[model samples]
Target: MTFEHAKCPLCLDQIAERSRLPDRGYQYQCPACGGPFEVSALAQRRAGKVGIHPGARAKMQQHLLDGKRPRVVFVNTTPNSYYEVREVNASEQTIIN
Candidate 1:
């Protein structure tokens, strides 16, 4: 398996390979500070153009009290095309069409 390295924006430490989740937009969790961050390809390209940092992380937890977990579409455009629904977590009820 291959690995990609990126600096943790919060701790400024190089994140280890085990902490990366490539499929989910190159998301990573810093081992030192436990901060969640993403190093997106588009952001890298823009950073190359603008000469800025290429990664972003959630703000401090106290600042996230009003934030909501994004609703993700689990199933859409099925063979029958009868319904579309989103979910925030597994325990939540499924909103039907």
Candidate 2:
């Protein structure tokens, strides 16, 4: 299988995408951030250039520690924005606050 490469939105580390989760997003198990991240195409570009806020990273890390997945849509879009974290269970998906 051909692997697609991109930068982790949380850590900006060069990472290998495990799968294309439809549309223009990728799923990865990033080494730097120490977890899995679901990132959209545009979000990857933003992370590479503008970077993300420390608070945003902390949020994601917290979610991971609590056993949730971090779904990154955009980072620091307005200097106060952060990516979304998804809570997956046996049923519906939720957006963690």
Who wins the TM-score comparison?
2
Each model's C-alpha lDDT? 0.34, 0.60
Please provide, for model 1 over 23-73, each residue's C-alpha lDDT reduced to its tens digit, 9 standing for 90 to 100.
Answer: 422343445644333434444333345422222222322122333222211
* Model 2 root mean square deviation, Cα atoms: 5.7
Among all candidates shown, the one with the greatest lDDT: 2
Instruction: Candidate 2: count the clashes.
Output: 0
State the lDDT of candidate 2 residue by residue for 1-97, as single tens digits.
3456666656655574555655746667666666565666666566667765566677777877776777666645665865555543424332221
Candidate 2, residue 92: Cα displacement in angstroms equals: 9.1
Candidate 2 lDDT for residue 43: 66
RMSD per candidate (Å) reads: 11.9, 5.7
